[model samples]
Target: MSFYLSLDDVPDLARGAAILGTGGGGDPLIGRLLVEECLKNGKKIEILDPTEIDDDDFVIATAMMGAPTVVVEKVPAGSEAVRSLRALEKHLGKTADATIPMECGGLNSMIPLVVAAEAGIPVVDGDGMGRAFPELQMETFGVYGVSGSPLAVSDENGHTCIVDTGQDNQRMETFARAVTIKMGGAAYIAEYPMSGADVKRTAIRNTVTLALNIGRTLRKAKDKHLDPLAELSAFLKDTIYGHGTVLMRGKIVDVERFVRDGFTQGFATVESFDGGHEMRIQFRNENVIAHKNGAVVAIVPDLITIVDVDLGTPITSEALRFGQRVAVYGISTPAIMRTPEALQVFGPQAFGLHEPWVALEELSAAR
Candidate 1:
């Protein structure tokens, strides 16, 4: 099914994307404001289900790449996203039929929307990564054997460049990261051009709708004076994600974060209210792993999210601060994301963590 997004839908979508981002993907506020700017200018944004696209339709993923912390300071120049998309189309000698999000995140989720609205195309209601990751090749399109070449990147100063790194997706990410740093730590990107048939096979289906439902669930729960975490967990259990739980509730005790290599790398420590238990989360743009008293509790491909304990509003990694009362929620990734092939691309080892990848459900059961 397809759906249309009015101005009224932006907030819920941004909120949901933020949670799914699992503490990365740039700022939701920046993305929301940009989308609103496009809407206010009379552009209509349409969202088509992945199934709606014809087999040969040209689709591309659009996103902002760089450290989430840097994105807040270096705002997009509004035209960069659409400019990159057009540049990619020019290179391919074909116009884009639709745009899709590179990942499910605050900034990334809305980048495709902005591009679609400006380019007069609809957005596919799905994404390359079901959740956000720090690097370009971590997306399923790359993991599932899609080339991320002829990638277009645009900076705020009206400069656009194309990088065609053949099938070496890691090389593409390396070169792209260097360009992003030179562009003042942030740039808009359009990559992983695919036919609709490829999208149906590689894209994580219905993540846009998933984000909307999560935002709606949190809002309704809050409105009805229900426990937002409880309601959210129950709702997630019935979704493709299959499992959701409050991993820990505590105050952030310490944070060590820095912007380096065009990425935000850091860890945060949260201590229980009674001070007996502690959880530490590590990140490289998005949360990668969480250790509860030195035991692996949640790891990547799965989602470890931080939210305001009372309001259920997601707190991105850049926003994690000392003394904030927060709840760390763990949710299982879809089966496709947990496959052996997918893990080799984005597992704990990929992030330099030594622990073997473990499912959130199994970890919870062990606990």
Candidate 2:
């Protein structure tokens, strides 16, 4: 379908996108602001279902990769996202019929709205991964036997890298990460290239519509002072439900952050709300592990999200701090997150752990 999305749809779409993010889409607030700015400047975004395009139509996925903390602080260079799209089109020897968010979460979701509007192309109502991941080659496109190589990664400075390792996506990941390191630790990018028809079989259908709905629900719940968490639980419980645990309802006492070797690293401790219990959180940007009383409770792939009980919003791993009262919720692992390949890809061991990774499934069943 040849349709353009407007600013009015941002709220629901962004919210719903967060839900599909299932606990890991970076953050959407800044992306919404940037997208709205683009919209105000006479940009237009079109949305299309995967089936709407011909089998031969070229499809690409775009997302911003880097420290989410850095993204919010710097704001995107504005034109970088759109320019990357245009640059890829020129490099591909074919203009993309559509651009979709590489995944439907955080800033990536809203980035496409602006990119599509500026480029006058339709944003396909689909994505490579239904949720966010921490790697370059971890998108569903790879699972479907598609390679991220032949990828064109462009930054805000007109510096571009044409990547085609001919079946080596990890090399592409390494190459892109090196670029990201030089791009001030955050770079706007559009990667996966596929056919409208080819992606339909692997892409999550109607996710954009679902994201819009979730956003609306959260908004209504907030205005009414209803439990936004409850509203979210009701909306996605079946697909993303996990054991509801307070983990350690506490106040953060200290936070230590260091940009070690160009990547953020740190640990935080939260003293119990009851003042009798305490917990420690470790991270490499996103929450990776949570421990209470020297016993491991919540682990990766499971939602270790910290939300302000009163504010009803999430606090990301990088931003965890001192003197903040928060509730840690244990949400189920995302569908894509549970895949053996995925667990292996983002497993605890992969992140420099000496211990074997604990499967979320076993963790869930044990309780």
Each model's total of backbone clashes:
0, 5
Ten-residue region with minimum lDDT total, candidate 1: 70-79
Worst 10 residues of 2 by lDDT: 237-246
Each prediction's TM-score versus the true structure: 0.99, 0.86
Report the C-alpha displacement of residue 18, candidate 1, in angstroms.
0.4
Give one digit per residue, the lDDT tens place, for model 2 in 1-367: 4456678877667666654443345667777877788778877777787778778888878788776666656677567777677777788788888788887766778888777877778888767655555676766677666777676666667777766776777788888878787878788776777877667865765556556766777788899989876777676654433333445577888888765533456788888877898788776655667787876777765656677766546676556678888776555555655677766666677667555656544654564
Off by over 4 Å in 1: none
lDDT of 1 at 348: 91
Model 2 accuracy (lDDT, Cα): 0.69
RMSD of 2: 3.0
Off by over 4 Å in 2: 1-4, 12-27, 51-53, 238-248, 354-367
Query: Pick by lDDT: which candidate is best?
Result: 1
